[model samples]
Target: MIRIETPLTDETVERLRAGDRVLISGVIYTARDAAHKRMVEALQRGEPPPFDLKGQIIYYVGPTPPKPGQVIGSAGPTTAIRMDKYVEPLLKLGLKGMIGKGYRSPQVKELLVKYKAVYFAAVGGVAVLLAKAIKSSEVIAYEDLGTEAIRRLIVEDFPVIVANDIYGGDIFEEGRRRFARIDL
Candidate 1:
């Protein structure tokens, strides 16, 4: 298993490949559709984003409210394709990694290669298991959006798989092809 920390550098991102199991630790941000729209709007207006984009990772999740004594709740990945429109602009701003689930659009995949970025997939329906990796959380922007609010998360040994790598490898496509040959 490969272990990676946040604020990934180009060198680190380049070293990853599709289908690699990764344990990601350190800081990542949370945002879903609403938050992403706001961010894109801010950029269109020539305003800066709520957080710096340099070498950051964004997790596409809208988690359940934490129960008492918990840092986060049910923090599973949302459909990655929903955020496809906002991805290229963020990638251009030095965003290096994303953690979510499912396939991204071909446009987004091409941008991943162009920007030397990678996309990681967290297992769906396993939010409770995933929340254990979050050490702390604080809302940093758009709190009015409730669960969709942008928050900073500090994670430790969070598990994910590289779904799309810097060189244009895509696990979803590869997995489909592999399964198609199964003679069951």
Candidate 2:
């Protein structure tokens, strides 16, 4: 398995492709629908909403409460579509990648192509397994949003699959076709 630590450089992003099995290490910021909306609004007003996203990976998630001693609670990926509205602007701002489940809208896909950004997917509903990789997590913004607040998480060998690559390859579509039973 390939390992990726963040502040994701362009060269590192170029090495990644759809279907690559990766073990991600280093820091990632978590943001979901509510936080995303706030961030987008902040961007619109030409104000910094906290956190420098350039060359960073954004994990679409809202984790549960940590079970004492744990750095974070079950932190699996959230649905990708919910964050679609925020993707393009961020992509334009040098955002290198996204980590979430399911598909993005056509416009988001278009931005992925235009900006050569990529999207990765983590296992859905597998929070326990997902949380173990998080070595640390802390709130960085949107504190009043609670769990929906933005958090910076330090991870060690977090497992993931590249769902969409910069070249427009899509694992979800390919997998569905590969596993489909066609009637003869």
Going through the candidates in the order shown, the clash numbers are 0, 0
Model 2 misses residue 119 by how many Å?
0.5
lDDT by residue (tens digit), candidate 2, 68-181: 788888888899998998888788788888999997787887788788788999989898999999988999998999998999999899999988887788888888888786
- Tens digit of per-residue lDDT, candidate 1, span 70-120: 998899999999999999889989999999989999999999999989999
Tell me the alpha-carbon RMSD of every candidate: 0.6, 1.4
Model 1: lowest-lDDT 10 consecutive positions: 85-94
Per-model TM against the reference: 0.98, 0.95
Residue pairs that clash (backbone atoms under 3 angstroms), model 1: none
Q: Which stretches of candidate 1 lie over 4 Å from their true place?
A: none
On a 0 to 100 scale, what is the lDDT of residue 119 in model 1? 96
- The residue ranges of model 2 lying beyond 4 angstroms of the native Cα positions read 181-184
Top model number, TM-score: 1
Residue 75 of model 1, lDDT score:
98
